[model samples]
Target: MLQNNSELKSKIDQLWNKFWSGGISNPLTAIEQITYLLFMKRLDELDQKRKADAEWTGENYTSKFEGQWIPPEYRNQSEPEKFAIDKRTLRWSEFKRMQAEEMLQHVQGKVFPFLKDLNGAESNFTHHMKNAVFIIPKAALLVEAVKTIDDIFAVMEKDSQEKGQAFQDIQGDVYEFLLSEIATAGKNGQFRTPRHIIKLMADLVQPQLGHRIADPACGTGGFLLGAYQYIITELAKKAGAKDLAPDEDGFIRTSVAASLTEKAQAILQQSLYGYDIDATMVRLGLMNLMMHGIDEPNIDYQDTLSKSYSEESAYDVVLANPPFTGSIDKGDINEALQLSTTKTELLFVENIYRLLKKGGTACVIVPQGVLFSSGKAFKDLRQILVERCDLKAIITLPSGVFKPYAGVSTAILLFTKVWGAKDKITKPATENVWFYEMVADGYSLDDKRNKQQGYGDLQDIINQYHARDAATDTDRTAKYFMVPRSEIADEKNNFDLSLSRYKTDVFEEVHYDAPDVILDRLIQAEVGNLDEAELAKLQSGIVRDLLDLKGMLG
Candidate 1:
């Protein structure tokens, strides 16, 4: 989405390069340091705005930067202790003006510790920040990074004013851009899902306010954030907002904070729950949500596949693109997941199902192999979806969708938890399953993934999916159609859910001439006796023409 502003993108690129040259070359490290700086700036600005707003509304306000501060470590010392520093000095605006060396020392020693304790001891973000290091080594590099961040924010403000895009939206985009710098996949095939794909899933699932939404393997909380944004945009729409615009992916969106009421904000903050095994990812996910105005994000460092995770049937919605590879130790896998295999991909599907309350919906991404693998475990997994739940849709994604990190073909599984035989003894829960084969996702499938002009099949998938009717959407030749449960559960198919199993391929008939006649025409062309139109036809169908010619020659 930041691609719309070349200047902002260039500035962020320069900021990243500055970090690379400044001895913090690791992307995760660089992003963490950048986040700290952005947090500093945002903290100061938000506090200032709130103070002013309180004044205008004649309400009491307590600024986080108010009052004198003493280092907690030195607070119990005897009299004459000189450890007190101005609380205001921690502000980005104040320290940015200091000489580079002094600025670095103040930030490293005081500001960072203050930030670590900003939310008090009980905060998850503060707990994660306990071990965080501010490693901008050189004074000149730190100064340049801070200056560049200021310029980036300046550009964002200008763009907001000129384009009517909310400043909060631009801020979220900036953080997303920074997160995108982490290019490599983590252990267990963990990689950031494309944001547009997340948006598409959020649209199909339609996560509403007050819904307990979750992502079990949330790397940087993209799905949770997407749901949050989707909810906010819907609220903005209901609030009579007319400035809403379609994003680069064609989904209408606005700022996360725009028109957000305080009561609604608190509920939204508590609605999102995420878990990840990687400590760094957990921290990043927490900050990712916090930076988007989700105070008290529920992301934590816990492997949901492990036995320790037991929050089954708890959430109203689950949106996830879990790790596509890696298997958990059989002994360590959560007993709640009853999938017959140790395959993480298969088990995660079961885990997501368990995570949902009865009748709750989930939109998950899984490897295409899960759809039609010959293994009995795979068949059982599909059967669980088809028999135990209402398997609504299977949207196959292009292989290149995860380019530069992975090339594995994937698909989105949209389903709802249901009581199959227990409630309906005569038949299964799912009556029909919809299928859509996505050809493109609005970007080039190469490493760069530059945005294309149109959102190929993305918009259509959303519209056609919501509007699909079992009786009307039966044309298998179209891009999207529905298949009856009996057909999907046929013995020969073995519960295969792959789109190719049911989709009808239309073939065109081609008329061919007799071999002798085709050879005579080619021979005439060889002798330079044929007209331009005859030569063009022969060239256009060279394979067929040459096959006929070779047979006649033989």
Candidate 2:
């Protein structure tokens, strides 16, 4: 379906309303309380399906699938029919009376053995849920909320693959919920990276449908999801007939929207890859991928900052918006990605640069000031890039790009591997660089950022980037300028990635009164009031008297 901004926003709001209607408002809290519900629902649904399948073959299926011992509890009150339902209310009071710790220990011992590898589950959630604090102000409200979500999931589960408008609607809602959680994460630089930024970077690189993409700093996996979207849309176009409308985008079966579970599953391992240090964020990122229809996500909770990968792991493309502040703890930074600089952003920049192959491309976000800061640390890094890599573009975004959000004046730097551009028989290989001042990335990002308004208008940018010629002296100060490899290679190699360093702003004029106008105003204000006239006369007399004396000239 065609979607305008208004349409997308409306759909997102629709999903939020659906969530409230289904009652899972506290996403942070719901997972802990809803685990028991999910377990019961799965138990009932799985056992019944197994029994049906087995009876068709005249075999005993109940004992084989549900477990060695069906929990005595399952026999009392059956699975809640929906993801929105609370598992606590039962016709089974005795089961509810089982102590929280004791029940989980017993369940973990006997029940979990059968339900291995459920989607969106982490082993930790199961291990901790029994003893996890379920401290919502009102336990009953929590119960009601869980029941509502139960109903919602039940409807969703009618078809295993998520697809169509409802799938889009539901997943869009989930995206915002995930963003909200990150927003509240606050100051830790766990703040949300605007999706448009990801989309814009995607446009800049236009990753081929089959290429691999990774975000080593994958916060909430925003970059990974963007890469997934790019691939999915492109893949659909490839599979579709030349003149016909698009084919089933992952096979739709519902009035609601969802990801094609199998399509997403296949893509998860092959296409999208990410890692983050924050365990909380890793969970949310996985859920974000799953809720958006990705099954068996590739996201992991390990700190990418502390790990290294082989040359085989080099990606065809890498996109990252590394956190702006904080230094990597001394002994913890991953050797592959770590830089000589203790500052985390600088370390990540060098890390991302190193991770790409001889010709791999990267689009990374950085603080505007990093481009020209004459520090000893960044200077050499800049030198390495200019001397070795093909440094292509710099985009300076406005200070308010983060507005009402967080104000971090930033820029995007583009680079590609040099391959044998170095050690070639020809002249120095990496030469011209393009610089563009996004002024705005086509969006307000203002609690209201718009794509059309800022650099979000990417078609022109992409075109200019391709048509861009070799570095030149004159174009260096133009709005969208070019700098020669020689200019960049100069002794300083300022590699200051800031766009403003190269692109000249169109300095606008302001009206100014002429000098006569200023003099007339001064005379009108100070001229012959009796006191002013007398003072002027006294001053004139003193000058005349002084001038008449030889001593005055001497």
Q: Please name the candidate that would achieve the greatest TM-score relative to the true structure.
A: 1
lDDT of 1 at 256: 49
Question: Candidate 1 regions off by >4 Å?
Answer: 75-82, 420-426, 511-554
Consecutive 10-residue window with the lowest summed lDDT within model 2: 249-258
After best superposition, candidate 2 residue 44: deviation in angstroms? 13
Q: List the residue pairs that clash in candidate 1.
A: none
TM-scores vs. true structure, each candidate: 0.90, 0.65
lDDT of 2 by residue, 38-67 (tens): 444434543455478568868665333322
Predicted candidate 1 versus true structure: per-residue lDDT over 1-554, tens digit per residue: 58789999999999999988888888888888898889888888888887998899897999889876776687788942588777889888899999989999999998988888787778888888777887778899989998999999999999989987778878888998888788556446776788889889999999999999999999888899999989999998898888677866788976547378889988998899999887888877877777677868898888999989878889999999988777889999887676768898998898898888999999999999999999988998899899889999999999889886778899999999896323563558899999999999988898888889999989999999999999999899999999999998988887999999999999999999977787777666664665788767766676466666677668
- How many residue pairs clash in all the candidates, one count each? 0, 40
Off by over 4 Å in 2: 1-139, 143-166, 181-183, 241-268, 307-313, 335-338, 419-429, 445-456, 471-478, 505-511, 514-554
lDDT of each: 0.86, 0.56
